[model samples]
Target: MEVIAERRYQVRGMADLVLRIGKPEPFPDGRNFLCPYEIDGPLTQRRSHFGGVDAVQALLNAVGAATIDLELCEEVVQGLLSLHGQSGELGLPDPLALTRLRSAGTIG
Candidate 1:
Protein backbone atom coordinates (compact mmCIF):
# COMPACT_ATOMS: atom_id res chain seq x y z
CA MET A 1 0.00 0.00 0.00
CA GLU A 2 1.81 3.04 -1.26
CA VAL A 3 1.11 6.23 0.64
CA ILE A 4 -0.50 8.73 -1.67
CA ALA A 5 -0.95 11.59 0.72
CA GLU A 6 -0.23 12.59 4.29
CA ARG A 7 -1.07 15.38 6.77
CA ARG A 8 0.45 16.10 10.15
CA TYR A 9 -0.81 18.37 12.92
CA GLN A 10 -0.51 18.73 16.65
CA VAL A 11 -3.42 17.79 18.89
CA ARG A 12 -3.79 20.12 21.85
CA GLY A 13 -0.08 20.17 22.64
CA MET A 14 0.12 16.39 22.35
CA ALA A 15 2.01 14.25 19.87
CA ASP A 16 1.68 15.12 16.24
CA LEU A 17 -1.35 13.56 14.62
CA VAL A 18 -0.61 11.94 11.32
CA LEU A 19 -3.08 11.00 8.59
CA ARG A 20 -2.09 9.12 5.49
CA ILE A 21 -3.94 7.99 2.41
CA GLY A 22 -2.79 4.83 0.69
CA LYS A 23 -3.19 4.05 -2.94
CA PRO A 24 -6.25 1.93 -3.68
CA GLU A 25 -5.43 -1.66 -4.38
CA PRO A 26 -7.31 -4.71 -5.50
CA PHE A 27 -9.23 -6.59 -2.86
CA PRO A 28 -7.63 -9.73 -1.55
CA ASP A 29 -10.80 -11.67 -2.28
CA GLY A 30 -9.76 -11.83 -5.93
CA ARG A 31 -13.21 -10.77 -7.10
CA ASN A 32 -11.77 -8.26 -9.53
CA PHE A 33 -12.86 -5.48 -7.25
CA LEU A 34 -10.85 -2.52 -6.06
CA CYS A 35 -10.69 -1.87 -2.37
CA PRO A 36 -11.39 1.48 -0.79
CA TYR A 37 -8.49 3.85 -0.35
CA GLU A 38 -6.65 3.16 2.84
CA ILE A 39 -6.84 5.79 5.58
CA ASP A 40 -4.00 5.51 8.06
CA GLY A 41 -3.00 7.48 11.14
CA PRO A 42 -1.81 7.06 14.66
CA LEU A 43 -5.42 6.99 15.92
CA THR A 44 -7.14 5.49 12.89
CA GLN A 45 -5.29 2.27 12.13
CA ARG A 46 -8.11 0.18 10.80
CA ARG A 47 -9.27 -0.60 7.31
CA SER A 48 -12.65 0.61 6.05
CA HIS A 49 -14.97 -0.71 3.36
CA PHE A 50 -16.26 2.73 2.43
CA GLY A 51 -15.86 4.14 -1.06
CA GLY A 52 -13.97 7.25 -2.05
CA VAL A 53 -16.21 9.95 -0.63
CA ASP A 54 -17.16 8.09 2.52
CA ALA A 55 -13.52 7.32 3.16
CA VAL A 56 -12.76 11.03 3.19
CA GLN A 57 -15.73 11.72 5.43
CA ALA A 58 -14.52 9.07 7.83
CA LEU A 59 -11.11 10.69 7.91
CA LEU A 60 -12.67 14.08 8.55
CA ASN A 61 -14.72 12.66 11.38
CA ALA A 62 -11.65 11.15 12.93
CA VAL A 63 -9.79 14.43 12.57
CA GLY A 64 -12.64 16.34 14.18
CA ALA A 65 -12.79 13.90 17.03
CA ALA A 66 -9.08 14.17 17.63
CA THR A 67 -8.60 17.91 17.32
CA ILE A 68 -12.00 19.33 18.27
CA ASP A 69 -11.06 22.26 16.06
CA LEU A 70 -13.24 22.61 13.01
CA GLU A 71 -10.95 24.99 11.18
CA LEU A 72 -7.90 22.87 11.75
CA CYS A 73 -9.74 19.78 10.69
CA GLU A 74 -10.85 21.50 7.53
CA GLU A 75 -7.29 22.53 6.79
CA VAL A 76 -5.98 19.03 7.20
CA VAL A 77 -8.76 17.60 5.10
CA GLN A 78 -8.07 20.17 2.41
CA GLY A 79 -4.41 19.28 2.38
CA LEU A 80 -5.19 15.63 1.96
CA LEU A 81 -7.71 16.39 -0.75
CA SER A 82 -5.23 18.55 -2.60
CA LEU A 83 -2.43 15.99 -2.41
CA HIS A 84 -4.50 13.09 -3.57
CA GLY A 85 -4.43 12.98 -7.34
CA GLN A 86 -7.82 11.32 -7.76
CA SER A 87 -9.63 13.75 -5.50
CA GLY A 88 -11.71 15.03 -8.38
CA GLU A 89 -13.12 11.54 -8.79
CA LEU A 90 -14.40 11.62 -5.20
CA GLY A 91 -17.15 14.08 -6.16
CA LEU A 92 -16.55 16.24 -3.12
CA PRO A 93 -16.84 20.00 -2.89
CA ASP A 94 -13.93 22.35 -3.39
CA PRO A 95 -12.22 22.37 -0.01
CA LEU A 96 -10.68 25.79 -0.64
CA ALA A 97 -14.08 27.27 -1.37
CA LEU A 98 -15.48 25.55 1.67
CA THR A 99 -12.79 27.10 3.84
CA ARG A 100 -13.43 30.52 2.40
CA LEU A 101 -17.16 30.16 2.97
CA ARG A 102 -16.60 29.14 6.56
CA SER A 103 -14.25 32.06 7.16
CA ALA A 104 -16.82 34.40 5.61
CA GLY A 105 -19.51 33.06 7.96
CA THR A 106 -21.50 31.69 5.09
CA ILE A 107 -21.74 28.21 6.55
CA GLY A 108 -21.73 26.90 10.07
Candidate 2:
Protein backbone atom coordinates (compact mmCIF):
# COMPACT_ATOMS: atom_id res chain seq x y z
CA MET A 1 0.00 0.00 0.00
CA GLU A 2 1.31 3.49 0.96
CA VAL A 3 3.86 4.54 3.59
CA ILE A 4 1.28 6.65 5.45
CA ALA A 5 -1.09 3.71 5.68
CA GLU A 6 1.65 1.44 6.89
CA ARG A 7 2.67 3.96 9.54
CA ARG A 8 -0.89 4.53 10.75
CA TYR A 9 -1.60 0.87 11.30
CA GLN A 10 1.65 0.55 13.21
CA VAL A 11 0.86 3.25 15.81
CA ARG A 12 -2.80 2.38 16.24
CA GLY A 13 -1.90 -1.11 17.41
CA MET A 14 -3.85 -2.59 14.52
CA ALA A 15 -3.26 -5.72 12.50
CA ASP A 16 0.23 -7.04 11.79
CA LEU A 17 1.76 -7.12 8.32
CA VAL A 18 4.68 -9.36 7.53
CA LEU A 19 5.27 -10.60 4.00
CA ARG A 20 5.14 -8.08 1.21
CA ILE A 21 4.83 -9.34 -2.33
CA GLY A 22 4.40 -7.65 -5.67
CA LYS A 23 2.02 -9.48 -7.94
CA PRO A 24 0.59 -8.75 -11.36
CA GLU A 25 -2.87 -7.33 -11.28
CA PRO A 26 -5.47 -9.32 -13.18
CA PHE A 27 -6.55 -6.40 -15.31
CA PRO A 28 -6.91 -5.92 -19.04
CA ASP A 29 -3.45 -4.40 -18.92
CA GLY A 30 -0.66 -6.18 -17.12
CA ARG A 31 0.33 -4.18 -14.08
CA ASN A 32 2.02 -5.06 -10.82
CA PHE A 33 0.31 -4.70 -7.46
CA LEU A 34 2.26 -4.21 -4.23
CA CYS A 35 0.76 -6.63 -1.84
CA PRO A 36 1.70 -6.08 1.80
CA TYR A 37 1.87 -9.35 3.60
CA GLU A 38 0.83 -9.03 7.23
CA ILE A 39 2.76 -10.58 10.10
CA ASP A 40 3.55 -9.09 13.54
CA GLY A 41 5.50 -5.87 14.08
CA PRO A 42 5.26 -5.88 17.89
CA LEU A 43 7.00 -9.18 18.24
CA THR A 44 9.47 -8.32 15.53
CA GLN A 45 10.52 -4.94 16.95
CA ARG A 46 10.82 -5.97 20.56
CA ARG A 47 14.59 -6.39 20.55
CA SER A 48 15.15 -3.60 18.04
CA HIS A 49 13.44 -0.76 19.97
CA PHE A 50 15.90 -0.75 22.82
CA GLY A 51 18.41 1.99 21.87
CA GLY A 52 17.26 4.52 19.27
CA VAL A 53 14.98 2.58 16.94
CA ASP A 54 11.92 3.13 19.09
CA ALA A 55 9.57 4.85 16.63
CA VAL A 56 9.83 2.33 13.83
CA GLN A 57 10.16 -0.62 16.18
CA ALA A 58 7.20 0.43 18.32
CA LEU A 59 5.07 0.85 15.22
CA LEU A 60 6.07 -2.60 14.05
CA ASN A 61 5.45 -4.05 17.49
CA ALA A 62 2.11 -2.27 17.81
CA VAL A 63 0.84 -3.56 14.51
CA GLY A 64 3.04 -6.50 13.68
CA ALA A 65 2.95 -7.47 10.00
CA ALA A 66 0.37 -4.84 9.18
CA THR A 67 0.35 -1.64 7.15
CA ILE A 68 0.59 1.43 9.46
CA ASP A 69 -0.52 5.03 9.30
CA LEU A 70 2.19 7.65 9.24
CA GLU A 71 0.03 10.20 11.04
CA LEU A 72 -0.44 7.79 13.87
CA CYS A 73 3.21 7.02 13.83
CA GLU A 74 3.88 10.73 14.08
CA GLU A 75 1.71 10.91 17.16
CA VAL A 76 3.46 7.95 18.72
CA VAL A 77 6.78 9.48 17.80
CA GLN A 78 5.86 12.73 19.52
CA GLY A 79 4.93 10.81 22.61
CA LEU A 80 8.21 8.97 22.61
CA LEU A 81 10.11 12.21 22.08
CA SER A 82 8.35 13.69 25.07
CA LEU A 83 9.94 11.14 27.38
CA HIS A 84 13.54 12.30 27.05
CA GLY A 85 13.91 15.30 29.40
CA GLN A 86 11.85 17.68 31.51
CA SER A 87 10.62 19.53 28.43
CA GLY A 88 10.77 16.31 26.44
CA GLU A 89 12.21 17.87 23.33
CA LEU A 90 15.08 16.00 21.57
CA GLY A 91 18.55 15.41 23.07
CA LEU A 92 19.40 14.38 26.61
CA PRO A 93 20.25 17.23 28.99
CA ASP A 94 24.02 17.02 29.39
CA PRO A 95 24.63 13.91 31.42
CA LEU A 96 28.04 15.18 32.41
CA ALA A 97 26.54 18.38 33.82
CA LEU A 98 24.04 16.40 35.79
CA THR A 99 26.81 14.13 37.02
CA ARG A 100 28.82 17.13 38.26
CA LEU A 101 25.82 18.62 39.97
CA ARG A 102 24.97 15.31 41.59
CA SER A 103 28.53 14.89 42.76
CA ALA A 104 28.54 18.45 44.14
CA GLY A 105 25.23 17.69 45.92
CA THR A 106 23.87 21.18 45.11
CA ILE A 107 24.11 24.05 42.61
CA GLY A 108 24.95 27.68 43.52
Query: Please, what is the whole-model Cα lDDT of each candidate in the order they appear?
Result: 0.42, 0.31
Off by over 4 Å in 2: 1-29, 37-68, 74-78, 81-108
Worst 10 residues of 1 by lDDT: 81-90
What would the per-residue lDDT of candidate 1 be over residues 5-94, giving only the tens digit for each residue? 556544332344454445544345544333223333333444433222344454444333333332334334544322234431232334
lDDT of 2 at 86: 27
Candidate 2 shows a clash count of 33
For model 1 the local lDDT of residue 2 reads 59
Task: Give the deviation of candidate 1 from the true structure as CA RMSD.
Answer: 10.9
TM-score of each: 0.35, 0.18
Q: Write the per-residue lDDT of candidate 2 for residues 1-108, one digit (tens) a residue.
A: 222332212223434322231221222233322223222343333211111123343343333322233213333354431222322232223425655897899875
Give residue 47's lDDT in candidate 1 (0 to 100). Answer: 42
C-alpha positional error of residue 4 in candidate 1 after TM-score superposition, expressed in Å = 0.7
